[model samples]
Target: MFLDASGSAPMTNRTLEAFQAGLADGWADPTRLHTESRRARQLLDASREAFAEALGSRPEHTHLAHSPHAALERVIAGIFTARRGRDRIVASAVERDATLHAATHVAAGHVSSVPVDPRGHVDLEALARELAVPDVALAAIQHANHEIGTVQRLADVAALTVAAQVPLLVDATASIGHGPSPAHWDALVANPADWGGPAGLGIVALRPQTRWLPAWPEGDDWAPGGVLVPAVLAAAVALQERREQLDATSLRLHRMVGRVRDAAAAWPGVDVVGDPDERLPHVVTFSCLYVDGEALLTRLDREGIAVGSGSACTTSTLEPSRVLAAVGALSHGNVRLGLHPGVTDADIDRLLALMPRVISDLRAEAGAPEVA
Candidate 1:
């Protein structure tokens, strides 16, 4: 039971085959004037359209980057540079690390963050107030919180952005394949790995009329050379598959996540986090008091069940998660459980049975008094 889909997903067999084929046939430089190059170009061009269509954008507006981190960083910096007059960026506090880092790098001291509620939802009123500032450069927010599974009120926020005439950059990294397209954002970015594609590719779509300035020349739009064609094809295929199974997968995963929420909530010293209803169907997070998150993970791993955690003890330092901190969560002994298509009812049952016992055991081991 490997339940860490939020970190990285296991590639399907088709995805591996697609990647192997890309290595064999797409190795040539697409920009070269040769037969092999021509073939590579064909694959690259084809995948571009497929990727755009998958994200509900026009072919002309999409570009594939080498990695999601590079895509988000460059896009954020490029847009920030182009919109020189706009001096500030407004983002929710709970965005992924890459987005928050880019926001800080691009806007520095001018970066203003909108706080989230205890439920991990962005403060819409505060966002509106921030966006109303004429000097606001852009608004950056995630389509969903990967850690907490909180889905923002996007359409309402988009309307506020429109009224304020601020461009929106949405990090759809976690939500793209898990649910519906986050439409109406001026720009969007997601990782192929998030949806069971290869980790090498990142998808970016900028609306045709969206105000964005490329840091490089127009001729070398995405990069100096072609991207990973095989990864792009695999991403497109994965996206189509995700859409086809979206409703059913959503219903099934939502039920499983509900089971997790119910079990974790009932356990002593564990607090279920995120919006129980308006959240990602595959993700549920909880914090256990008086237990070290890493110890719980190790204990669970020994039982052949792997999960993810977000504790100060597990992260870089003894610092708690900024996400949990932003939402007033305990931040110690926090675990984020993200499910995928690979997960079965048995896996859910295993997790439910293992979670409470390990958490309680870890608490006891740490010499902490147990709660009811």
Candidate 2:
């Protein structure tokens, strides 16, 4: 059974149907004056409305971007461009590379990173201190850590940013569909594909009172050209479906992840990471001593159980996970299991049954000494 559900997920049947129907109905240019274009316009508007409602924002304030990375960059660029006098970007150490890179670029390398605890929770006092600093353009924090799944103290962070009068840019790309994001952000960006929607659609929302301007040249302001109407329709449909089942899905995945954590922790030289009780329901990460991340993942893949290793976002690079490194964990030999709604109990069982032997054999291959 394939168990790797790290960054993206498969679309549900209902969402697929909506996408198929939209392909036939929403193909025209939404900005044109033709009847077909008008139909496409309606589809785009309806999809934006549905997605905006999910985010607790008005459709007028939301924009469709090509991807979550684009949306995040747009938000950061807009804020920094409008607040020209301020050149500093404040963010937590555990945020996505997209957030850090964009913030750094916009702020001219004046980005200040707040430290996080070993469990991946941000240091609130340090964050407040950083925000209080002058010339701070914006502060960015994720709703949760994509790698370790530690939910941030966003409400408290929001309070601090508000007190400091700095715009808060929240990256909810990892947390939106899995649970309710805090309604305390000044600007927010999310990924549709992360929640089992079609790829290539991103949701970006801004509060009405927020100070932001398009940083791009005088062209298509929000999205460079436009968004795919069928993709947006599928994303909206998928988000609605996920929201309808959020509570039950969260509970079920939480239990299944707990099983994985428990099973992994019982093995020798294994350390389970993240805030166990207050983490994302679907994500669990752990580090194994004397085991190579790639080898362990390869063994699991060979055993018909696919999984993820290294940085959740930059898994292709296979570099030691910066998230794990920040939290002072062993970054080299880690595995991240992202449990989706489609992962069955039998799948979890099969993984649990296979892990001990896999770890033991890998340790033996490494000529590693036994853990005390």
Candidate 3:
């Protein structure tokens, strides 16, 4: 079987087991006065504790949301509203779409995008310069990129923001369970799916004493509304399991990704994106000159190999990946691979053996320059 780790992996058995166990307990509003409701509240509280411990934060500080996007949006809006003073929002140019949209939605400020190096890393010096301005209210950067997998110097960025007395919101969706939580940031957001948990839940942990005003009217202390108890419990259990597997899983996936990088280097006209040595262990991206990324993705899928194309977000849109464009990486013929613990050695070998042929076919179809 081919490796399909590019955001296509299903939830692990451990997570499913946890979900089933939770299902047997019963369903009740966690805030209710009944015994079952109190039990539900206990479960939610326990889940919060588990997630908080994994992220190196206090349980009460963590906020559960319906999705990573929701968490990010809530956190950004809360920060922007609460810390309003300046009319500028500073963010890395390569931030995820949800963040970009949130920043754009707030018409009160001008958005300042910090440029990244060609290797897909934020220039800390540039960030420092921007943060130096007293008018910058909030700054956002990812702990690691989702597409190219390049890990950023979050601590350095956080320090600069702290020096500027600005709140730094980090999207750790791609890094959370694979490595240490970026506790240095003012606000942190991550998805459980990235750590082999169910897709519906996202965790946002805010620093204690961080003041946040909700963007919408709310009766509860949850970021926007009350938390999803079952999803939260499932996410916590899944995160714990993913953390337990991190050391070994990272080593194995790193080796596999290294092989992919080496193979891509040998292929003519193929350029790997991101800082190869400084990127996350489970993901890598590359571009094949002159071939269309969508076509390549289709060909791979036909051959039972599933991977991600950086060319488009949704199937309806054909725009190239903004993340790749921000770093000056090739926008065409792009492929992104994200590995998880469920992927096996055989799966990697299958993908490796099939890639060369797929590239050759794609090149022929596109009438591209020879791989020289």
The candidate maximizing lDDT is 2
Each prediction's total of clashing residue pairs, residues at least 3 apart in sequence or on different chains, is 0, 0, 0
Give the TM-score of each candidate: 0.96, 0.96, 0.95
Local distance difference test scores for all models: 0.84, 0.86, 0.81
Compared with the true structure, what per-residue lDDT tens digits does model 1 show for residues 160-188? 99899888999998888888888879889
Off by over 4 Å in 1: 216-220
- Using TM-score as the measure, what is the rank order of every candidate, best first? 2, 1, 3
Candidate 2 displacement at residue 117 in angstroms: 0.5
Per-residue lDDT of 1-372 in model 2, one digit per residue for the tens?
Answer: 655565688878999999999999999989899999999999999989988888988899998888998888889999888897899999889889888888878787698999999999989999988987788999998888777889988889889999999999988998888988668899999899889998887789999898888788844368877889999899999989999999999999999999988888888888899998889999989888888777888788788877777633336765677788889887766888888898988989888888888888889898998775
Cα displacement (Å) at residue 320, model 2 = 1.6
Q: Residue 201 CA error for candidate 1 (Å)? A: 1.9
Model 3 Cα lDDT, one tens digit per residue, 1-372: 434453334677777877877766636777779999888888888888988888878888888888888888888888888876776889999999899888888734588899999998898888988888888768999989888989998777877888888888888898888876776888899888787777767788989877778876773354445656666777788788878878898889888889889988888888899888888888899998878777888888887777887875334677778888888888888888888887788887888788888888888987876877
